[model samples]
Target: MSLVSLILALLVEQARPLPYRRVVFEPLSRLADTLDGMFNAGERGQGVLAWVLGVGGLVLAAGGVFAALSALNPLLAVAWNVLVLYLTMGFRQFSHYYTDIQLALRMDDLPRARQLLAEWRGRPSDGLSSSDVARLSIEAALVGSHRHVFGVLLWFVLLPGPCGAVLYRAAAVFAEHWSRRSEDPAFGDFGGFAKQAFAVIDWLPLRATAAAFAVVGDFEDAVYCWRTQAAQWPDDGLGIVLASGAGALGVRLGMPVVEGGEVADRAELGTGDEADVDFMQSAVGLVWRAIVLWLLLLLLLGLASLVGG
Candidate 1:
């Protein structure tokens, strides 16, 4: 059942990707905002409560629906799983930005590429070079693929039903929204809770993603970088994905970039050639190959289960 639902969800997502702003996610955003207003009392306990209500409420609701439908018919449960996964998982959610940046770089339009990168990341790109843009783009693609696809699938398979996927995505959204420094001062305490919660949730999935990259790409180098450089990045979750991806691609990533006349020195990762326009395609290929590997593993497991039964 898990294998079939995942395969179907991927196919549906590939055929017709969901838009960035959709009705399904709008209510989730509003719910987060509501929770913030109601429970963000600038206290640690309030923050924990808000995180629980925000993440747990959705998971329970989805699980309830799946359970009710499953009581009626097993096919209904499968359909529900597909719908939830389709809404939650897909490469196209972030791939368009990657493709646009690649196209801009290929056309030798560094400015345009920088602008696209800034738009995708919601940050300033004042003095990013062509190499900087390429490296950041590839890094973003790798991390986004993990967050938007592999993590969701892994959670869905781990838990009883679609609830796991919903939990993973909701926690991620909450963490990203609240953990930023630009938010209201009251949210600082709240943001810490969300950030820590997401770290716990994402811990295993990030390593799983790194392992997939290692298996499909350069195993030894990916493992070496995962051990050596993953801790160098500030966020451990993103560090694992980016470090392994950099090694998988056999390219150098992370350097100082002048943003608004400030040079922010980033930790050096991987070892080899510097990133270029052409490596973007390699990154995309790496992600697809990892997806294929995941599906094959699931298929084999399903076959083994059937034989044992």
Candidate 2:
């Protein structure tokens, strides 16, 4: 049932991607804000409670619905799973931006490419070279693929029903919303809690995605970078995926960039030549291949189960 639902969801997503701004996510965002407003008292305990209420409540509700649907009719439950996965998974949500950036770069339109990158990332792209644009676009694509596809799929397969996917996506959204450094008093003290919770949730999936990159790309280089360079990045999850992907593509990443008069120097990852417009296509291919690998594994497992039965 899990394999079937996942396959169907992937196919449907490819056929018609969901809207970028989903109505389903809006309520989750509002719920996070409500939790922050009501229970965020600038205390550690309060922040923890709010995180639990905001994330756990949603997951529980999703699981309850799946359970009820299963009791009424198994097919209805599968349909619900497909709907949830459609909302949660798929690369098209972010890949469109990636494609636009790639096309702009291919046409020697550096300014347009940088503008697109800035718009997609919500950061300034002033003074970024063509290489900078390529590297950052690749990095963004790799990380986005993990959050939107690999992480969600791992959790969905691990836990029964849609609970795993819901939990992972909810944790990611909450972490992104509340974990930023800020000086607003109403923001409360949940940033640390949100960050730590997401780290715990993402720990296994991050490494798994990295391993997949190694298998599907340059195996030895990917593993070497995964071990040696991942720690250089401040965020552990980002470090793992970026390092692995850079090595896989054999492209240098993490050069210094001047954004808003501030120079942010990132740790270098991967080997060989620096990224260019061509590597953008390589990154996209890498993600699609990873998805194929995942689907193949699931197909094998389903076949094995049938044989055993």
Candidate 3:
């Protein structure tokens, strides 16, 4: 079932890629916001209530959707999976910005490149060097790939199959979203709660991605970097990705990205980051290699299942 659903979903997704994304998350996001508002009535226990309100809501929602679709028709269930997969798994979510910045760099346009980075991160970019910009862009792309792609795949494999993909995606979104809300006088506790829950959600998959990078990129260096640096990163997943990607490309990737005032998405580049031509090439290679490795692993699991059956 996993193999067939993956194959079918990929075929359909490839055939008709979304032109531009619409707000598929509005309903869920609104639901989360509403519950959080009511339960997060106090500052002290607010974090606890927000987690119960946000994650608890998603678990119920995804399960309900799966149950309803399974009852309606198996094909309908697959369709539901496709909808979630379409939103969850794609590089376009973050890569288009990279492409624009890369184009700017190719023309030797430093300021423009910085602007792109700043806009992405919602920060100003007056101090970035050309190399800094390039390095930061590579790091952001590498991490975004893990969060938006590989992480979702891992979660689905472990849980309620493709529906788990949706759950994983929701978990990621809320984590990033509400965690940032920690700064908000309004939703601060909700954000903090989201942060904790998502940290738990991302713990294993982040390591798995780092391990994948080590195996496919430079086995010794990637592992060495992960062990040495991953422990130091505030977020385990982000640290593992940066360390492994730095080793994979044989470049420095652990430079601190400037944090914007808000709980801005640290998983991406802010403005003023540049991309090295060589590092970009290597980053592309690392991603494709990782993809091949993941597919092979999936294929192996499928084969093992067939043998057992």
Candidate 4:
């Protein structure tokens, strides 16, 4: 049922992508803000309480619905899973930006590519060269794939019903909203728990994503980069994904780049040719292969369980 739900959801999403911001993000962002306004007191405990109320509350509701549907009819539970997965996981959520940027670059339209990249990442791409645009787009695509697809799929498989999917997505959104406000005087330690809690939740799934990339890509190079370069980046989890992805693609990433009229220093990851439009296309292939690998594994697991039963 899990495998079936996943496949159906992916197909449905490919056929008709959701308006993600309107459907999921806006409501969730409002909820996070409401929780912060109501519960935030610039204390760790308050942060924890808000996180529980936001993320845990959503997870409980999803699980409860799934349980009720499952008790009434298993098909209803499967439909619910498909609907949740449609809302939560899909390449179309981020791939349109990537596709447009790739097409812009292919046409030698650097300015358009830069604008697309900036809009997608919410960061300035003012001074980036073609190579820089390709590098950043590939990097963003890799991380986005992990976060939006692989991470959600892993959690959905780990927990019953759609609870894991809700858990991963809610935690990620809360972390983004709450964790980065540490420098705000009014926020103080209220975001501390969100950061720490997401770190714990993301650990295993991050590695699993890296490992899948390794298996599907240049295995030796991916493993080598994962060992030697992953820790070099400031965010270790992101580094793991980027290093492994760069290695698999045999493209260089994470070097210093000019952004906003300044040189933004960055650690180098992978050991191969400089990133280009070719490598960006390669990245799409890599992500698809990884997804295929995951589906195969799920299919095998389902077959084994049937045999045992």
Candidate 5:
């Protein structure tokens, strides 16, 4: 089911991609905001309560959709899952900006790249170097990959199904969306909570991503780098992925962000060869390896279940 949905969704997304600013994303964005407004109360216990209520609503919504499909025709569940994941999954959601920034850097269009990187990241990039441009790009991609793909995949596998992925991804988007708007007093405190939640939600996938980096890159170095250097980042998993990637691509990935500048890693990341398709190649390879590893494991697990049964 997982493999089928992922493949179908990815194919559907590629063949007829939806625009990011489309009306579809707007509702999801609104849904997230509404949930946050209802739940995040600046108290730990209340926050948990909020999460419970918020997640409950989300789950109920998914169940309603699933039940409706099941009633109409069980086969329709596939279409439902496909549609849900089509909107929820895919590199296209965040990678377009990644690709654009990379292209801007490649063409030495630093101003355009800076403009773009700033908008995508909600930070100033006016003084970015090729490497700063590259580092932040990689950092964003690393985190985005987890939220957009791995985290979603994990939730889908762990919960009732892809609905879990939708829930988790929604949570992630809420965190990011809220944190970015911290200047508003109403949202200021939400950043801490959102960032914290995103970190906890992302922990498992980050490690998995690091392991994938090791498998596809300079195996020993990537592993060693991930183990040692990754812990240095503000985001534990972010640290590992970037560190392993730095070792793998031989391109330095970040300086520490301004002390306490958010969960972001880079105060003054070191410079290196410009980030390029090769880096994207390595990232793509790592992602595919993770997917293959997971699919094979699920297949074997299914086979074993059949044998045991």
Candidate 6:
């Protein structure tokens, strides 16, 4: 059931991608803001409570629906699972931007590439070079693939019904809304728990993603970068992913970039040549290979369970 649901969701997503921001992100963002407004008191406890209510409530609701559907009809439950997975996880959620940026760079249209990348990142990209554009796009692609697809799939497989899928996505949304505001006094400890909570939730999945990238790409350099260079980046979890992916692709990433007329110093990852259009294509292939590896594992697991039964 899990295997079939995931495959169908992927196919449907490829055929017709959802308008993610309008459909999924906006509603979830509103929910997170509402929860924070009602529950936040600039305290860690309040933040924890808000996160629980926001994230846990969604998880419970998804699980309840799945349970009810299963009781009524097994096919209904599968359909429900497919619906939730479609909303929560898919490559198309981020791939269009990546593809457009790749095309822009391929045509030597630096401005268009920067525009696409800026839109994708939701930030200014006025000063980035061609290499900078390619590098950042690859990084975003790697992380987005994990967050949108691999993490959701892993959790969905680990838990009953679609509960885990909802849990992972909801938790991630809350973290994005609250966690990054830790420095603001008004949002103080209200975001601390969210940051930590996501860290805890993402710990295993992060490493699992890194390992899969390594297995599907260059094994030795990926492992080496993961072990030696991952810690140097500001966000340790993302560092692990970028490091491993860069190493796997044998391309350098994360160096000083000219942003807002100032150089943003960043620790470099990977051990080989600098990132370019070619490596950007390589990154896409690496991500697809990782996805295939994950599906193969799920297929094997389903087969094993059937044989055991």
* Best prediction by TM-score: 4
Model 6 lDDT per residue over 62-133, tens place = 999999999999999999999999999997978999999999999999999999998899878998889999
Candidate 5 lDDT, tens digit per residue, 71-109? 898668777788877777666766778788878877888
- Which portions of model 1 show Cα errors greater than 4 Å? 21-26, 181-184
For residues 1-309, write the lDDT of model 2, one tens digit per residue.
888898899899889987745655666677888888888777878878988887888789889999999999999999999999998877787788899999999899999998999999999998998989999999999998999899999999998899999999888888877765346676656567887888999999999899999989999999999999999998756899999999998998886788867999778999989899999899888988988898889899989999999
Better of 2 and 3 by TM-score: 2
lDDT by residue for model 3 (90-176), tens: 666457678888888888999998999888756666667677677778877888789767888788778774656766777776665
Q: Please identify which of the two predictions, 3 or 4, would achieve the higher TM-score against the true structure.
A: 4
Instruction: Name the best candidate (by lDDT).
Output: 4
Arranged by TM-score with the best first, the candidates are: 4, 6, 2, 1, 3, 5
lDDT (CA) per prediction: 0.87, 0.87, 0.70, 0.93, 0.67, 0.91
Residue pairs clashing, model 3 = 117-270, 117-271, 118-271, 133-273, 133-274, 134-274, 134-275, 178-191, 179-191
The 10-residue segment of model 3 with minimum total lDDT is 264-273
Off by over 4 Å in 2: 22-25, 185-188
Scored against the true structure, residue 27 in model 3 reaches a CA lDDT of: 53
Q: Estimate each model's TM-score.
A: 0.95, 0.95, 0.83, 0.98, 0.80, 0.97
Instruction: Give candidate 6 misplaced runs (Cα > 4 Å).
Output: none
Candidate 3 accuracy as lDDT: 0.70
Give model 1's TM-score versus the native structure. Answer: 0.95
Q: lDDT, candidate 4, residue 34?
A: 97
Reference-based lDDT, residue 53, model 3: 57
Q: Is candidate 2 or candidate 4 better by TM-score?
A: 4
RMSD of 3: 4.6
